[model samples]
Target chain A: MEQWRFIDFGLVDIRDMMAMDEAILKGDGDNTFFFWTPKKSIILGFFQKAEVELDLSKCKDYTITRRISGGGIAFSDDRCRQINYGVVGTIDNDLFPLDIIESYKQVCGVLIDTLVHYGLNAAFRPINDVTVDNKKISGNAQTRWEGKLLQNGTLLLDFDIEEMLRIANIPKEKFLDKKIASIREGLTWLDRELGEQRDMEEVRNVMKKKFEERFHVRLKTGTLSSNEKELTKNFLPKYYSPEWVYR
Target chain B: MEILKTKPGIHKARGGLIRSFVFVENGILKDITISGDFFLFPEEAIFKILENLKGTPVKREELLKNIEDTYAKEKIQSPGTAPSDFTESIMKALEA
Candidate 1:
């Protein structure tokens, strides 16, 4: 059985978080499962333009940044109750598939299992979403560097729908076309589903265990390596610059 | 010389919602920027696709051919998006 390094990097800033994620992908290290939360911020998909996806005037209260992964926009903050986790590793067909869609199924299945352990009726919605009661609880995205792959997902513990809507410029017609009626109808969170706020540490424990059990690996608690730290230092400037975020 | 007009269009593709901001002058695509929640593999290829489409005639057939050529050249592996989906969004922007 392979051994994976598990690091819970709780509550980092959005830019440093992005830099660290990229550093881990590019740096040589053990296959890692990383958990973190960002200080209040809105993260955009790599391809999304800030002007199109965000109401900049209404987003004054939150930091706006773009991640290197391709997917939909997401709002993250510990206060709003969101947890983020990333799985970084080289391509291994037996462990994780090479195909993008198939890989989403493989990684998202772990999330579904974690949610199920908490007694939520969770399911994997393809491309990349984990849903409970047919409403999305998690959205995931991926990016590749050389032979390495980094897939990260946002798990909503308790969502602030109004805040999200205020910052994000989602079209009302988008909901109508999906027959979703309203944005609230299309999203759900762990607290909403369970009727109580789950302890963050407990949730993290469950995810660590689920990941270890499902993949038949031992998760040794570890921190970023020296090389990863150096790479992150080099990458930090790019992530912090307005040129990168607004471009 | 015609004034370049930036027209916006939105389309919900099988993959995800795609938005296109096309700058057209005299029925010629001067520049374009495609943005959306859709996933495109080798993600940087989107820029190349846009760069390649500059100065393309805004007609449906011509737009499709240019985009298709770029898709093929990039060896794009977008799961739910195809060249035609982008072309449709771009065409919508042109018409708008």
Candidate 2:
């Protein structure tokens, strides 16, 4: 059995997460787990052309980054939101094209167990979403490299519909409803559902325990190698540039 | 050249804010243009690649293969439009 390491990084740049993905894909790092916050950012999908998914004029006030993984655009902030990344070795090629659905289910299982531990209702939704009472609480994305998989997702600890609506190009009609009924129908947050507050640190601890129990693996803490740091330095500028962010 | 305009089906709610226009001349791809407000990394590089592919033919597999390669190298983030979607949209437009 191979050993897996879990690292808790309180807050990090979205670019660094992406650079780590690239490094792992290039076979530079061992299978690892990463959890962090993006200091208020919107990360767009790899293939999603920027102009269509975002309102540049509105996003001008905030920083934007493009993720190497495939998924729709997502908004991130300091408020109760936690983003987690898992870099694991490939399981089997027979499940080629990668069983994205199964992978999501495995991760969501840990999340659901954690939510249940807190006495909150959470369930996995098809395609790639984890929701509470049909309202999305998390969105996940995955990418493969050199027989390894990098799966990452966002857990909404709180609600930020105002900022989400502003950055994303939601229909005007949906925005007019002051109640945000439509948006509310699609999204749910821990703060809203539990009527309490929780930060990334708390979320991380609960998640860590759940993951260890569910996967039946011991997670050891570790740091990036010198090679990874060098790669991150080179990748950061490119990721931060308008070319990568707005492209 | 036939200029085909169609809603990028993936994102239809925002008045088809994601637009893909492929310029085909007699079944051959003269040029391809993917324009919209969607967030894509290295935005300018998308157009540059499209411009470079101007003279290429409209073979579906070839188009997808080339685009994927160019995207990896340029690190253009917009999954933009898939080749199958591109081919279907263009075929629909040409027929119209």
Q: Interface RMSD for each candidate model?
A: 2.4, 8.2
Per-residue lDDT over A83-153 for candidate 2, one digit per residue giving the tens place of the 0 to 100 score: 55554545463322345567657767777887888787789875567888777788777666656667777
What is the C-alpha lDDT profile of model 1 across A41-128, one tens digit per residue?
A: 9888998888778878887777778888888887874375787999997778767778888888888888888999988899988778
What's the lDDT of the predicted structure labeled candidate 2?
0.63
TM-score of each: 0.95, 0.73
Per-residue lDDT tens digits for candidate 2, residues B1-96, read 232233332222221223455656786778655533333334456566676667666665666666666777886543334434444444443353
Cα deviation of A75, candidate 1, in Å: 0.4
Off by over 4 Å in 1: B1-7
Best by lDDT: 1
Please give the range of 10 consecutive residues that has the lowest summed lDDT in model 1 chain A.
A170-179
DockQ score for model 2 = 0.12
